[model samples]
Target chain A: MFSPLIDELINALRILPGVGPKSAQRMALHLLERDKPGAAKLASSLQQAIEHVGRCKLCRTLTEQDICATCTNPQRDSRLLCVVETPADVLAIEQAGNYSGRYFVLLGHLSPIDGIGPEDIGIDVLLERLQNEHIEELILATNPTIEGEATAHYLAEQAKRLEVRVSRIAHGVPLGGELEYIDGGTLAHAFNSRQGL
Target chain B: MFSPLIDELINALRILPGVGPKSAQRMALHLLERDKPGAAKLASSLQQAIEHVGRCKLCRTLTEQDICATCTNPQRDSRLLCVVETPADVLAIEQAGNYSGRYFVLLGHLSPIDGIGPEDIGIDVLLERLQNEHIEELILATNPTIEGEATAHYLAEQAKRLEVRVSRIAHGVPLGGELEYIDGGTLAHAFNSRQGL
Candidate 1:
């Protein structure tokens, strides 16, 4: 609203998820008034990231190099592969500090209504990787939403055809979750998947 | 966390007001995965804004040129000058579509504990402008906080010395503000400032 450059900056900032017009304006003014140097650094960093970062050839996760850190790390178990919807999911799993397997990021789930199918989510590429790699177990770690479930089921069929053991990540009450607040679907899943303790 | 470039980008993004580590990570991943082109545009726009936008010489609001649009607009009431704390305040006032006077930005309010004083807020520059301009009335539109009140009182003294009429923006119940939820200070002000029907 102040100048063309500022207007452009505000519009560009709207690309960020959850940032609306008012928030974008606040961010733009904040950068201009308080942190010009930081804004410049952010600009350069954005350009560098956009130019350098791309999908890892093997896992489809974002990386500056041909392969991502997890994909190339020798310490991770190559015998087990985790399939996830996006790079964010990979970060979440890694942050938990429990999973130590290689990952294959689908980037999106299969949604036939939206015209996103197996080829759309790079299923062929995943199938090719499974065939070439020594991965004996495939863990479907996609979200528990309907699209994620459909994608997992389809991938499981492909893994079975290739004679690879496939497992879906458990759907149950979260560790800190209260049963009273847990959704019906999750509670049902927790009950159905009950194991002797 | 993924790579050096990604890490740098995330750090740079954290410069935005109110964005924490998790939000920065989410924004970075979203740009990388969903909107690379938009991210590039934002980068370029940020650089452009940093290089071009600066404080308007007259009004102290953000501008690409020597003078801001508000300062240059002949249609505005130049005889009535409004003093504010920041460019964001100017934007907020303009958005209200009621005020038509010129503006002088202090950029900050008086905070003695923080070592902020008249010079720090460009009080001398404002005084000089008042001396040279034909402004007959000075409106103290600073915020209602303690610091804002101190700044406004100080500026009022200066305006009185300059032989210009000084007025503080009224603090009353905001439009559509419910009395039941309004703070005691604001309710008292509203009652004190009650006008004829």
Candidate 2:
């Protein structure tokens, strides 16, 4: 049958979520049969990332050096800070190309059931950074999940004592969507956060 | 937010078939956070397989040594040889656990349009092997595609002159499938290969 090497390659590809044995096998075969350059690129990238990427000393986001480009950029607004649950979330916001503020990555959200607390997720570090960084505004850009909401609310309360303006991203029926198809949570949020048209 | 290493890892994972940017980001983060053991296992397996498994000198299947265990085993019916397109196909048949005969892996199917001919897919090597070996029955287990059919026909013609019994795998509606939904090619195959109940 296929070489053990092929199987290993297939299994390695299966590290992606939702990729089962069959999908892994297909991917491995495809890499071998067609995309040699792509496969080599992927392998080299994996090795390099594993060897080089580390947490930013200032913001806790993933970075190649002690400080991320966002933190080091003098042109960015140091007075405006956006907080998110993970490093990936920061990238998602950055990709939108609208946000011109600095960011703080939490590494995780508050999950009391899982024993994850604010302190555990670097809240103390964030607080220290907030006080010292001369920030005027704090945007809690965490996801709309229950844990994300709790974390954001907790951060807002903390920011109030520090005399920094805090705000949450509004939740509503999505753009270009039917109200009837929207979920109960979003519907409730839409009703609560309603504005006169 | 995420480290450059994490970004690179996500990009690497995205190169796989069916993986998008979001999925790759999720997967890279997952491996870093929860599936460390799985990732390490996968990496170790990759290194091991790459270092260990090689092509079987006889059948072209993956093997730890020069000849595959299947090819060298004395208990197998060497006279009744099954031909498949790849080592993966051999494993599939083996998993089915019905075929006791030995196998010859072609490494690839013939595709004349892609400049892959009979010899390029190892048909000449197969012929030489057949001439030297003690094979009686040659079962063609190539896939059910147009290229697979053409290769089977060519092999059958070649084996016909050699006076060896040749058979192609039956093509029809799959087991547990309904006849009403069966395609024309399968219906025709079923009609031709029909057996009395």
Candidate 3:
């Protein structure tokens, strides 16, 4: 409402997820009013990231180099590859500190209704990696959503043909989750997957 | 977590209001994965805004020029001044499609406990405008918070000396609000401010 520059900035800020017009305007004003230096730093950083960051050729995870840190790290278990829908999932798995395997980021899941299929998400690239690499086990760590399940099952079928062992991450009530609050689908999954404890 | 450029971008993005580590990472990854061109555009827009947008010389609101459009517009009621806490408040008032008056942005309210006082919020500049301009009415549109009340009271006293009429925006139940769900203070205000219906 103030000026064209501010309007442009506000519109540009809407690219960030979950930011509505009001929030974008607030952000624009906040940057102009209180944090100009920080805004300038953010701008330069965004430019640098946009110019340098790209998908790692091997795993499709975001990186500035040819291969990502996880893919290049010799210490990680190269024989056990975890496949996830997005880089955020990779970060979550890393934060859990349980998995030491490398990752293959699908960047998105297969959604036929949305016209997103195997080839759309670089499944052929993942299959090529499976055939060439020494990976013994492929862990499907995609989300529990419908699209994620379909993608995982399709990848498992593809991996089977290449003689690679495939496994899906367990789906159940989360840790510290109350049984009463858990949804029906999750409760059912937890019940069906119950093992000797 | 992925690369130096990505890490830097994520850290820089945390400066935005409500953005945390996880949100920053998600934004970084989403930009790298989906909208590189949009990211670049946002960067340039941010840089341009940072370089151009500054506080209006008259009202302290954000603007690309020395004076904001509202302050410069001749059709708006210059004799009626609306004093608000921030530029966001100005935008909110404008979006409501009411109040055809000029604005004076205080940037913040008088929070004595936080070591913020009248001078810190440009009270002197407001007094100068009151004295120099032919303003007939001063609308105190600050927030309903304690600090905002104190600021409004202080400005009212200052405006009284200059013989400018002062009025505060009513604090009452919001439009379409149910009394059952309204807070005690708001309900009390609503009851006290009840007008002829």
What DockQ does each candidate score versus the true complex, computed on alpha carbons?
A: 0.86, 0.44, 0.77
Comparing 1 and 2 on lDDT, the stronger one: 1
Candidate 3 wrongly placed segments (more than 4 Å): A112-117, B193-197
For each candidate, the alpha-carbon lDDT, in order, equals 0.93, 0.81, 0.91
Q: Which number leads on lDDT?
A: 1
Candidate 1 lDDT tens digits, A63-139: 99998888889999999999999988998899989988999999999999999989989999999988998889999
Query: Where is model 3 chain A poorest over a 10-residue stretch in terms of lDDT?
Result: A22-31
Per-model TM against the reference: 0.97, 0.92, 0.92
Misplaced by over 4 Å in model 1 are none
C-alpha lDDT of candidate 2 relative to the true structure: 0.81
Question: Model 3 in CAPRI terms: which quality?
Answer: medium
- Model 1, global lDDT: 0.93
Candidate 3 C-alpha error for residue B98, in Å: 2.8
Model 3: per-residue lDDT, tens digit, B89-129? 99889989978999999999999899998889999999998
**How does model 3 fare in lDDT?**
0.91
**1 versus 3: better TM-score goes to:** 1
Error of 3 at B40 (Å): 1.5
Clashes of 2: 6
